[model samples]
Target: MKTKILTMTIYKKLTTKIHFFKMKIGINNNNAGIIIFLSVFFVSFNTALSVTKDSITYVKPNEYHGLLLNDTSNSIEKYEIQRLNYSTLYDILNTRNELFGMSLGLNGHYNNFLSYGAIDNNIELGINGRSLTNYYNGKYNLENYSPEFFERIEILKGSDAAVLSGHPNNTFLNFQEIIYNTKIPFTRLWYAQEGGSFISADAIFSQNFSKGWNFTFGFKKMDDRLAFDNMSTDYWNLRFILRYNIDSTSSLSISDNFTNNKTITSGGSDPEQSLNMYNPINSSPYYGKIQMRNFRHDLNVTYSKKMNFFNITNTTYLTSDINERALPRFDESDTLGNTSNTETQIGNRINLDFTFDNIEFKAGSNINTFNSEGTNFFTEYSGVNWNLYSRAELKFTKSTSISGGINYGDDSKNGFIGFGERLEHRLNENSSIYLDHSFISKNGLIYSNDLENEKTNLFIAGLNLETIKIEGYYRIVNSPIFNRLVNEFYTEQYNISDYQAFGGSASYREQVLTDLFDKNDKIDLRLQTRINVIVGNDELKNYYPLFTFNAGLNYMLMINKSELNIGFKAGLLDSKTAPRFIPISNSYITTTNNVGIQTTGLNIYSIMKLGNAFVKIEWENLLNANYYNVAYYPERGQIVKLSVVWSFFD
Candidate 1:
């Protein structure tokens, strides 16, 4: 209780400081106060104003009134399906591995630009494909960064019988979950101030000639130190969006965002050492001026109509270019491989959704093309890849939905691979099941010789329940794919086909006190668990188990005109097996025998509100537990940050 009180007092004092400064800076406006507060809490300026509450708390997926999703479903008799939206930095850091393909299921990665439709804290994530150890030489950051720029973030699980055409699938791919992040423009001008000295400004203008046609543009810039060690970033984002409603049932929309960013690392380099000194910080010389560039563009359109028997909707997405850094393993080390890489991805998705009473259907197709080129030691390897797939789902009733889909594509330089058919069935609201089969073949092109194709079979089942705000779920999955010599990057032709995997996960959350102190204030507690296993050829163990557990306590408090909130979360994970690099290769290899539950660490955050302003503070690795996010590298220890914000309202 003493700790909680102290945290609250600090936050309240900080909030007062923020408000006082805003007024002293010649920004004497109530709305200005709100804007300042929101910017600090949400860590964004892209979304200027929110008529409704931006969020109940300061970070992504913030919780309000003991509810995760903004809205609830009333059709369900027993459980109110609630979607989780707020997640912390730990949720991003604790995910054990990547989900492999597509963006579904429970993956743990940071959603830098927080989008919606995610479960667990690990759900909304952006992953880096390239290695982190060699960033200095400029291998180009191959990471998918998710930033938060939405007014509200919401996640929907289950079959989504109310929305999409068909019943949702029980499997990751079959699941029709949608994350919606809404953005609303402020009637007043847009503006902001960032960095230590409060440097700020805003830009917004628009013109319209026709009733349905309009054009608008906006630009905002903020330079701030996100952390210590001179780790400051300059962010300049520009956006242009146009929308035209053609009649009533069809509409065309186009938008583009250009973000220019500059980041500076303050750490210096090291003296030369033997091969044993593989650590980048210890062996390589570091100078300032390390930089990165990114460019992304997307286009989409939609059409919908209500018919007598069935409602119809058509949507399409075309993303052209998303390009990032190109460089070597390290600038200071000549022994390290020097390489440059750039990739271009073009993709298209089209879906047709229709409904008949309680039964619904969704049919869609997707195509993607990728091209990559390398320089230096990797210069000889340049390739193009393509993938095409078609999917469909049928909903027989509210409680029962089934789906089937097929995928076909060619790697061109590699070979042809295809998925025959997949099916899913929902037994009831709390449980469901699924089955899948696929065919794969690979060719020797960039790194190795010719390899034979293999077949795969997969199965899964799920169960979920929510009682009195308590939520929990369990899942089992069986997957089989062609097993290869993971240690060998370039191999003389060899075949080892037969890899399998099984995984399970569960979670729980309960409100310990609503109106514990105030009618609008409350306290909550939560717990989560996960497990995974894999089997088949190779060393490392025929069986391994991965588990993760998380717990947290949250409270919302109010004193007079001020409102205060605080929360703490801690997690433990045991991966059983750690990754080992194959000598002379860039890939990581691991065995199935690895098993054990090791403690990772803990994280905590606190928030306080005073008048219209708020303060937020966070500390990571509370116990100073040393753990590796990667095989040899130890993650940072004991980090704390304090920020204050005020929102402006008319």
Candidate 2:
């Protein structure tokens, strides 16, 4: 109870500070009115001479909420009826599911999150807008923001990146925006609670005005304690969206978001000592007091119009991020270390889509400029990049299509060009096959002069059978940059001349026991599996896993008016260099050789939905396995969490 009170008090104080900051920034009544007037005028002008459609198309309020209730039907359909499931926000908060194609490391409150298949090590450390990956010195600074801030998260895996804006060899995550348009005023209130002293509150208000004008405002606050000791997380966020329908073929949307967050770091323990059956778990040797404060603001505007034969879209965004960290040394000799980093970026994208007879064309260009500075860095860095891409799809028949694209990018540091081709054949209404190949050259990070440009070649083939999917891929990378632990708390990058990787994934989904029961009384089953193997001429084996595998299953049933979803997930990793905690920096350092232990573990979860309320229970490390993904950082023991979310809408 006291802890809860303290968390609330801290939140209140932070909110007060933010309010004062807003005042200092002159967000007073005058500016507020001006903003409103400009928004209204722009929307009005855009729709002045446009045609209105009789029917309105908009996202339903409960679409995302249904996912939290274990209803994956909509998401499955969105993914072309593939075997992908929606990850609930509760699961993310508890670190139960890190999503597919990504890995997450936990050091108390500090999180080291990384996306795979990036050759530019500096891009992993700094903010990379092209890929939407944000980090600070290899630590995931974006973890401070809650997933609720976004309308939806789309996971693009394997060859799916061929159509996206990022490197074709790596997976991409797209955080979609939220726009609400309804004939009547709508409001929603939500509250969620978890066993680990986690609490979240949210409110959303939206309305559709005359002349196809709509607006929405959303606010969220979250407070939580880490599963381990002396760690906590807290954040508050606000989002506003303004949307206008110019006509049946045109629309414009503007969104703004702000967030403030704080987290406390807790260094991990030594695996050898802690995992010993005969010895008691010992505290981390290099424990220190560390805290990080993060503030972020983003503004985005999008306009789309459809002409007689072509469609055009323009999108612009501006983002500002500030982070501050304070670390008190364990010893009294050194003074407290304080560091601050600030980054700002402005970017714009224009795309044109046209269709001529059986051929469809898409052309787009993106330009971005970014500047970053940090107290610990020797000097500030700034860069500008321009990317142009064009794609054409030829429909030979109703069942087959071939598409190809070429991309050229130039930056202050380097220039690169790439091309890809994809052939998709529909076997039937419920199945299809596709083959794709890509060759891409990526520029090095602007902040690092030591790194060189990198290139990759990827080939992928896949089959989709409505409820099942199978895919295989092979990739070769030249001058791949890999991260190496420099000291207890820092990492450096080294280039690998040649590297190769092969991987495959398969998934299946079906309704089970339907023959014995009615259609409405049947059970739903889902299974997904993936494996990867890496090889290289250099001694890169010690730096990366030789083999890795992941498998997951979910079984869902409906009883009366309630739904139950039960799931199990497992992961396996081959011996390789693994991360270890560095208390001083509140980050992780990698180990050399195969000294790191090969690790495996199983996790289980269940969700029950009754009306507008959902209850989720999760048990991590169900097998009580004693393993470590990172060296000297043992995995947590069996931990159970129960969470509940109640939503009300009108």
Which candidate number has the best lDDT?
2
Which residue runs of candidate 1 sit more than 4 Å off their true CA positions?
Answer: 1-146, 149-240, 245-249, 257-342, 345-347, 367-374, 377-390, 411-449, 453-455, 467-497, 538-545, 558-563, 580-587, 591-597, 608-615, 643-650
Write candidate 2's Cα lDDT for 354-388 as tens digits: 88888888777878787778455324767786777
lDDT of 1 by residue, 422-465 (tens): 34444555444544433323232344444554333333334444
TM-score list, all predictions = 0.58, 0.76
- Error of model 1, residue 413, in angstroms: 4.8
Alpha carbon lDDT at 299, candidate 1: 38
